[model samples]
Target: MRLRIKREDLSAIERHSKQSFPLECCGLLVGRRTGTEFEVLEAVPAENVKRSPTLFEMDPQFVHAVLSRAESRGLTIVGFYHSHPGVGAYVSGKDAEFLKLWPGVAWLIISATRELIEERRAYVYEGDEIRELKIEVY
Candidate 1:
């Protein structure tokens, strides 16, 4: 599978991740799924209620609102984006469990630091394993 996102949208997500610094930053991936690709149109920033460096929990009310707005705009909530500050971009144990709730939706993780954004990886959970999805930015 692939997540096709605009360069600007991805840049915004990356910038937010950096701005959040040591604390984890999180957001919604708004787009539509087509064929084998999730065409990401926007990366809507969301409040990380956890405010922790190791864990992130998107605000429930904000999630609900984003979902509603996307639906109204004829878009789907394809997945989510978050930064793993200091840690590399891979699905953590907690994140793997979180993916179960959203099924096939892509979970985009930014491996970030104050100095570098090492990687941007996206994953999807199916059955028992976390599968990596290729990301395309244009």
Candidate 2:
């Protein structure tokens, strides 16, 4: 599968990830999906209710608002994103557990070190497996 995101949106993720250093940053990916391609038109950064270095939980109200707004703009909440401060852009066991709940939603993982974004990876869970998705910046 393919995930396409705007350059500005990618930069926004980097900036948010950097600013939330030491604490994982979480957000939603707003856009549309066509066949095998998921195109992200916006990055809706949400408050990390958990506010922990290793964990992140998006505020429920914030998620609802974003989802509602995206729908109004003819967009869908196709996926979610989060930062992994000081770690590799790979899914951890905890993330896997969360993935089970999201099923087909795309998971965007950003790795940052000391306020600088190092890498960005995307994945999708299917049939009890986590598979990486190709990213295309536009």
Candidate 3:
């Protein structure tokens, strides 16, 4: 299965990525599944620990509020997103391990550096394995 991200959603991700340069930024992917399609509803930025490479903590309050809003809008938390400063856009082993427990969600990774804002990539957790996802940003 594949996911389709609207243009506005891509814009939001880009904006957040630029705003949080030097430090990682995190957010939630709010959307609903229709038949085989996953339509993104919105991209909600969540608070993340500043300059912490070993840890990523999405603010509980922000998460709660976004989930609440998604529930009200008949949507759900489809996945999570984070940037990889200098590293390329690929799921790390740690990321695969973390996603093992939540196998149904998508993992979006963005790589931003001095040269360019790299393209985003998606992944899925199947058991302890991390599989690359085909993502189309529109």
Candidate 4:
């Protein structure tokens, strides 16, 4: 399946990736389900920073908070995003393993280096296997 991201959303992702350089930054992909398409509503960054790169444990309190906020507005958590510093935009073994646990959720990995920022890639997990999904920014 293809995931279409608006220009504004893409910009937000880029900004967050740059702002969280060196340390992986994570956030939620909020949107509504629409006829096989997920129209992105917003990209909500996590305020807590207990978990950094190599690990991401979304605080239960924060999750509840966001869910409560979203509930009132009729939105939902669609997927998640994170950055990979110095690594290419490809699924690593650890990522694959993680996907096994969070199946059906979209994983967006932004790769950045000291000199340049690589393209972002999205994937979905299906029974321990990660299937790359097409991403169209703008």
Q: Which stretches of candidate 1 lie over 4 Å from their true place?
A: none
Give one digit per residue, the lDDT tens place, for model 3 in 1-138.
Answer: 667798888778877776777677889999986654556778888778555643467877788898998999889988888887777887777777768877878888888754458878888775566777677777
Number of the candidate with higher TM-score, 2 or 3: 2
- Span of 10 residues, lowest total lDDT, candidate 4: 47-56
Q: Each candidate: what lDDT?
A: 0.91, 0.91, 0.77, 0.74
TM-score of each: 0.96, 0.94, 0.87, 0.83
Candidate 1 — which pairs collide? none
Q: Rank the candidates by TM-score, best first.
A: 1, 2, 3, 4
Residue 70 error, candidate 3, Å? 0.5
Error of 1 at 61 (Å): 1.1
lDDT of 3 at 41: 72
Evaluated at residue 6, the lDDT of candidate 3 is: 89
Residue-level lDDT of model 1, residues 3-69, one tens digit each, is 8999999999999999898999999999899867899998899989999999999878889999999
Tens-digit per-residue lDDT, 9-122, candidate 2: 999999999999989999999999887788998898999999998999987888899989999999889899999999999999988988888888899999997657789999
Which candidate model has the greater TM-score, 1 or 3? 1
